[model samples]
Target: MAIHLVGLALLMGVIISIYLPMITQTAKILGSGPMANIPFFAIALVSSIVIAIASGSRTEQFQKVATLPLWLLTAGVMSAGMIIGSSFLIPRIGIGAFFVLLVSGQVLAGMVFGYFGLFGVPASALTVGKVLGALLVIAGVYLVTFK
Candidate 1:
């Protein structure tokens, strides 16, 4: 379990390193506005299709065809909206700030959802340490962008 945790941490670190740079470049291409979402949509479309084929699944059978929840659909739509919105925002804010705000938003949302046991996550509250850590991340974002 410890090894698995370490491996996952390392993998996430690598992903962050790669993703941040890509976001910066994408922002540059899209002029730091919401238009960046076009590439996001294209990537999502290709990935979804690839994943479906690789996993031997389709939208109809993706997750219980008839019982698809509205909440999930809403979340999916919201994510797409962010992708589009980010395209426009990235150039102005820069990728570092963009990711900081984006990740912080995710962390806040995740904690809220986890606390309420929403989306199958176990109920939990944000600890003081987590709050501090988030603050530090925000501070880091400020330093990275403004300084």
Candidate 2:
């Protein structure tokens, strides 16, 4: 579990480094629109397909996908909105401020999602400690953005 967390963090850092520059460039060249996301999604889909094939779990994954609820499919929609929004906002706000705000929003949303057990995850009630941690995240974002 800890290794998975570390791996995910590393992957996220790499993706962010790649995404911020790429998306910002896309916005500059293409001007943010459905077209901007077209290449982004296309690349993501291709990459996913490649990874799925490389993992040799194509059949298992396809079976699992069939079992997944329709609501889970909305993740693509959410991802598109995030990517489009980031493409538009990062160019305007600067990556530092954009990431601070983005991370702050993610932290807050995660807390709420965990508290409510949204999307079928195990319920984890919001506690005082969690609230304090979230507040610190907001304070950190403010300090980074304003200071």
TM-score of each model, in listed order: 0.64, 0.83
Candidate 2 local accuracy as lDDT?
Answer: 0.83
User: After TM-score superposition, what is the CA distance of residue 64 in candidate 2 from its true location, in Å?
Assistant: 5.7
Error of 1 at 96 (Å): 1.3
How would you encode candidate 2's per-residue C-alpha lDDT over 11-97 as one tens digit per residue? Answer: 997798688668768867886655688888898899998999998868877778878788889998988888788778876777888
- lDDT score for candidate 1 against the true structure: 0.71
- For all candidates in order, the CA lDDT equals 0.71, 0.83
Per-residue lDDT of model 1, residues 54-126, tens digit only? 9865656755745876777787677656655655566677766777777777777787897788878899877
RMSD of each predicted structure: 3.9, 2.3
Stretches of candidate 1 exceeding 4 Å from the true structure: 1-43, 57-63
Winning candidate number (lDDT): 2
TM-score for candidate 2, residues paired by index: 0.83
Clashes per model (N, Cα, C within 3 A): 8, 0
